[model samples]
Target chain A: MTKTFDIVFALWPRCAQLDFLGAYEVFAHLPGANLRLASEHGGDLTGALGLPLRDVEKLSDIERCDLLFVGGTADMSAATTPGMLQQLRRLGEDARYVTSICTGSLILGQAGLLRGRRSATHWAFLDQLAQYGAIPDPARTVRDGKFWSGGGVTACVDFALELMADIEDPTYAQMIQLYIEYNPAPPFGSGHPSTAPAEVVEALRARFGEKLGKIGGVVPTTALT
Target chain B: MTKTFDIVFALWPRCAQLDFLGAYEVFAHLPGANLRLASEHGGDLTGALGLPLRDVEKLSDIERCDLLFVGGTADMSAATTPGMLQQLRRLGEDARYVTSICTGSLILGQAGLLRGRRSATHWAFLDQLAQYGAIPDPARTVRDGKFWSGGGVTACVDFALELMADIEDPTYAQMIQLYIEYNPAPPFGSGHPSTAPAEVVEALRARFGEKLGKIGGVVPTTALT
Candidate 1:
């Protein structure tokens, strides 16, 4: 019985929250959760928000774990790096549970893990999964038994909790919820594209303005509502 | 009036999680959500679990923010840096929301922000809040009137969602909950001192084994329970 668990994630210069911290929380629970942020060389990689990360463990050293997360990437057009996709397939096969969030789902798909499977990704990037023959789940987190796919970045937490329930005890998840206070409150009436005011939606659009027209489908729906 | 926010946090070699990302999600939702991860120095600060963070904004730039999350310290007796308390006091005067999570609530108390106020922290350290004349709440997220105190690290996300509801749209939190697929599934049934196996708890004690006895009250649950 191993007390420690190592959850691995890919490092990109522009990975989103779902790619990193989103799933990081769930992995944080293992007895001595050894989180490994792996890159080609393992040093410093700038995150999407300009936060530079350092002291990453080289990917090769990670041998096995109870969980492995193939974090999504924003760049789909860019060619997959040499051996990266191959490495993901290897990790996915070894870990007890394999999952992905947002565009990372695409990364897993690219690795041939989701072929003929049902999976989820960030709404903006779901189309990429089509080439992999995965049944796209627009929902927050989708689980096809052992294969888990997270919808958006934040969806990782919810999926993580569900994973917690499966791996640990249901009560453990509830206890964490009690400890962390899972109660939610929303200020605006809108969280999805449909509910947001035209201006608020546009405001969000303007923020991601550069990436529009490339993806398929509408915005996300409020989970609780 | 400006949606710009300054998120002040203590950053060093190894900071806690709930302290960093929990509030980030909420603060990032403000209109512009222009976040500044204020640290003692503007460089990499490794967090628990070997996750390293970098490019932190220096503490000097905090002008105003919707919320200021004071993270907990691994070395509290040696932890209270001098000028930071002063800066916190200065920021406390004008910030729209003054919040803390896990041990961060203690930092807020040391900054004189938690006096006569109720706050929250990891259950393992909740009793410590009483040392600074603040009431501790067992709930995942605790609010003393206007002050928002979060229990443990994971609770920070819940607290952030609550705060987000106040400032942004209530639905956005729901959307975030749904988007992230917050449904949790912990592999083990333990994340807290009470529920974790006796050996696990003892192991943790051995790990933080050197926690000085000065905060004896914080360690023993007799007073808080």
Candidate 2:
């Protein structure tokens, strides 16, 4: 019998709910994969929209895993925390695959795992990858060797299936996709910045520019909270 | 200024995470929308993928809301639970709009909310809507009169934006869509039964047929554990 594939997601404050939960569900449903949530503090972590994740393992306690999954958050402050960066770096160094979804690439980049690697992240923050010596690509998902990153929040679904396909097979990915009914139909047809009206994009920039700008470089850990 | 719109989601065991969470995040971010999760028992409800939802209000405590949302789970078990159905009926009756995601429509159907209405649900179980006198349409998202239903887990995003557009304006919905970067690109093209391979669909039917059959008719509330 094959050994179980261990997958761990680094949980943090204000993480996007879908970024980790979406991919976590896909892997949890897959046969022979051990799934867990890891965080600085082990219990009752909150993500966006007041979503609570229970029974998370302390990050320092987990020695290793087959895959280290990092997800992005609405606030980038956690990514720049010295302790968070160090933990991500340590986990990335040992994991068989270091993967991320949405702005999670920012965390990976800050950890030095994406140094000289091509990556993809939320389109609005793709250029910031350069600050950490990573090449940013605008694709929905990008893979460079063992480093995998996805675009924005919804891109986590794509990243999950693609990673599943790579590790298991397209057949396994297809089956899970069907079971979950992965069909997506955006009613407004404007999910991408390019597809959205210029005024709408400007409005979002005005709304979130300050928070997003903080992601371009790692801020002092003390600056957070 | 318009009165704050009230929205409530019926929470239950095994509820699909994306079903309500996807839509909830969008609405929670929208201004003037009061969002709350209401479950039969309330307090620290666990859903699919072991995702914990915080601060869910007790269903009996919520008298009315502008919109009543219900989400689906892997099995149809929760939909047939008498207590859940009664709460849904009570809430749906008072709400201006009754909405659901994935097989959540099954719960609405069981509560008699979908009686004589056109609805959409998870593709695999669409035909079962007939058991509750509902017209099942395969559209990604369907809005008939005051009832709105989405096709599957991922369809919640579309259902959310559409509902947002209806309550607010298209531009507001577009702005939120851009903020979340809702651009969806499924790595595998098979998100629907029509697009997935026959073998994959067959495998799913074989795996889930037993749990699914119980949903065709209302099971005794006592039957649920």
Candidate 3:
């Protein structure tokens, strides 16, 4: 009999749609995968880019899940709410694997889950993880025990594929890769800070650095390292 | 002044979310992009994998757009409706570029927009494009005049980046690419039939071939070559 895996995605207002959507597409294709999207309040919410997401399940209603996933959000205040963090801490304890994409690791950290664990986040916010006792790793995808994390938005796709291999098998994951035609032919070589032009990197740093400060301010006094 | 490009995505029930979401993430960052999502009827609709999409604009209400995009769908029936085709034809006529990801080319073909055009679609459906007078191009992204098409689902990201380079400039597109951190590192190299294991390819072909037949059944008599 095929074993059904209940995978829950914890989302919030202004969450980066692609951060979770990329992984959602991958896990949705997995045989016996039961994917659910949830939020603190549930129902409708607007993505960071104003995309409307509807029919989200409430976090309080879900009892437990095989995997608990969270994606990045532009607004840190909504993600760091007391109720949201409480749910994450509760769900993360029971989930077979606790995972995240981009700055989502920061949320996991805020939930008091990433302390002393090596995790990954967006290239721009890698250093911020240490504030929550996370040993930030620069790899696009990092796996330390059951806490699996992906870097940036697009890396969620890669992270999910790798997680599938761990949860199921490598062959199954490779098949999903072919199905999605994920042979990425990036038009340019400027995806990372290391590869992007110095001027472009500097410009984005100035923009994202301010957002980083906002994220830092939201971290609770008790959660800080 | 940054010239605002009014881009419209033509969505339908069962449309693959990732097919357009990948491109949407890239285009949403474009300096002057005005993106909108539309369906035959304005309201909420379920995506191919049961993801809820809300506040979709009505197709008939949109007079014209700078670019028209359609993504692949699991159920092609919703895509070939007379009203849907009519709107696509009307929008494609005035749009600066008519674009699609994955099997969306098949929908464009039914709308009579792909007649005698070189295009691309999902690898599994490439040959089927010939029935609609489209010359199937194996390349991941194809552009013939103002009609741009991407191969399979994930190719939409590459297609959008290339289109950005055309609409704005390479540097601008590269900047957007960096913002998304689109450095794709596929955990495996089985994205295409040529690279995937023969057994895996055969399994998917058998599955997708049944879907291809359903697509063929829906092609209008006048549209077929």
Best by lDDT: 3
- For candidate 3, write residues A156-176 as lDDT tens digits: 999999999898888778878
| Per-residue accuracy of model 2 over A91-176 as CA lDDT, tens digit each | 88999899998888877887778889999988777887887799999999999999988988878888889999998888878878
Instruction: Give the DockQ (C-alpha) for candidate 2.
Output: 0.68
What does chain B score (TM) in every candidate? 0.82, 0.89, 0.92
- The CA lDDT at A61 in model 2 is 88
* Candidate 3 Cα outliers beyond 4 Å, as residue runs: A206-225, B1-3, B206-225
User: What's the C-alpha lDDT at position A24 in model 2?
Assistant: 81
Best by TM-score: 3
Q: Please, what are the lDDT tens digits per residue for candidate 1 over residues A1-225? A: 267766777665555654568567556765556677776556777665555677766666677666778666545432145456666677788888888887777777777788888898876667657777778877767898688977766666677777777777565555554334344433334444445556655545455445533334432211201
Model 2 accuracy (lDDT, Cα) = 0.80
Residue-wise lDDT of candidate 2 within B50-137, one digit each (tens)?
7756677888899899999998876556556777778888889989999998888877887888888999988877887887889999
lDDT tens digits, residue span B1-225, model 3 = 288888999999888999999988988877778889999998998898878989999999998999999999767788888889999999999999999999899899988899999999987778788888889999999999999999988999999999999987887777777777788888988888889888777666655556555422343334332
| Model 3: how far residue B143 lies from native, Å | 1.3
- Which should have the higher lDDT, number 2 or number 3? 3
Candidates sorted on DockQ, descending: 3, 2, 1
